[model samples]
Target: MTTHLSVRAPDRDVLSDPGYQAYLVLRVVFSVAPVVFGLDKFTGLLADWPSYLAPWINDLVPGTAQQAMYAVGVVEIVAGIVVAVAPRFGGLLVAAWLAGIIVNLLTIPDFYDVALRDAGLLAGAVALSRLAVRYRSVQRERGSVA
Candidate 1:
């Protein structure tokens, strides 16, 4: 009797295949989520995180909570654009920004859920970065780095 064994290889061939789709999905999701939330920061269409923390933000940030909100909006919007247009650096930037948010959330007890979500999003961004790095490396080896 002959038995056939199939091995899922992480070699260049497998990495070159549709496996990179995972990266694209993560990239798009991370990119879009920031854009959406960032827009809400400006438009107040979504739940206003600031209002919830208004009582404390003034005491914490020294009369700069509103400015901080706007700044966050700008950062998130820019990060979103970067992630959507420039995949290479965007993933890393988004991951870093999300890490900052996670830190801030850790300091706030009421916004734990938002912080957790941010963490999950940050993980996705990291996954995208890893995938992007792997794909780029594979492409460079093949002289087709995109």
Candidate 2:
């Protein structure tokens, strides 16, 4: 005779809502990505990012494109930190940053795909903002229920 038993608990699916999972994943991604890319701007360990800057934006900045990228790096780092602490507002900041990136990529020749990708990322950040609000409300309700 053999005994059959369930090793997995059915109650463990508490956080299994796909939308909630996606929102959580986006939170982590948006949190870490900007920080990593921003830090890379200073190190150039990834690439000399200034080379990707549009000539038009370069013209507007007083110093070198590298200097402007350094400034961008600082903003990106702050955005990541803000997202980590408060995604509701930070998501909009990231969306704005992505919009700026999209515009910049548009100015460069032969980078339409990258611009398109940034646009998608911008949309995701916006979605993340909405999702964060909803998730917080649900969490509050759950807390009250408990």
Candidate 3:
């Protein structure tokens, strides 16, 4: 009897699989959540937010919390849009920004919960970045430039 040999290769269509769909959902949620929070900065939906900054942020900015909030709102909205649409560079930007937020949250003892929440979000950002890169690479390999 002749010897038999088998070689296994990766599934090329993995990017189009249901797992990728889940990734898309998670990415969209992560992107949109920031937009909502960013808008709230302008609207002051969280009654405690301004007061929470009454001690430190005010001293740092000096009569400029509202202006600073507006700037942050604009940036967050733009970043959210980028993540939802562009994905590639957007993911990188989101991940970097989230890292900064996480770092800041860690400095405040009362914000430990927020810090933990951001840690989870940071993981999601990383996952989205990987998914975007993987999908792009797969498309390129398959000769379908997207």
Candidate 4:
């Protein structure tokens, strides 16, 4: 029986090494920042995160705005972990999440600027995702874990 090696014969992947470094930086920031913010959600040490929720949303929620934010925090924590585990797709998830936040802020009064800022972050997240795909592809070609 011929035991064929099914794995792709991989060599070193040096394409866009510098660019991959940028991807790594973005991955770390996006991954760790959410965990930090999610933890802060429980303590409310950074800011009154729930207060930022639109008044209408606060009313729509079953519980206090704080409780809604706790849920948001949980989602953020999971998203952050996802980014750490799978940045290629996770960055896109974060970007989508930011787009939703931006939309929410746009619905609220006097938060257009914050929404725009988040839009910028969303762009960064997109770039990170694209770059990460290339980086991950390289890692796979190299037959190594990043």
The weakest ten consecutive residues by lDDT in model 2 span: 5-14
The lDDT ranking, best first, is: 2, 4, 1, 3
Off by over 4 Å in 4: 1-16
lDDT of 2 by residue, 1-146 (tens): 99964333222343788887888898999999999999999999998799789999999989999999999999999999998888889999999999999989998999899899999999999998889888776766555210
**Candidate 4 per-residue lDDT over residues 72-95, each given as its tens digit:** 899889989999999888899999
How does candidate 2 score on lDDT?
Answer: 0.86
Instruction: Give the distance in Å from residue 49's predicted Cα in candidate 2 to where it truly belongs.
Output: 0.5
Superposed Cα deviation of residue 12, candidate 2 (Å):
5.6
lDDT of each: 0.75, 0.86, 0.72, 0.84
TM-score of 2: 0.86
Query: How displaced is residue 103 in candidate 4, in Å?
Result: 1.1
After the best TM-score superposition of candidate 3, give how far the Cα of residue 8 lies from its true spot, in angstroms: 30
Candidate 4 all-Cα RMSD = 3.9
Task: Write down the lDDT that model 3 would get.
Answer: 0.72
Residues 28-115, model 1: lDDT tens digits: 8878988888877777778765754434445867556666677678888899899877677899899999888777777776778988
Candidate 3 lDDT by residue in tens digits, 1-146? 89965433325566468766766776788679779978988888764455434345557774676776777678888889888887777777887887777776666669878878877877878788778787767656655543
**TM-score for each predicted model, relative to the true structure:** 0.72, 0.86, 0.73, 0.86
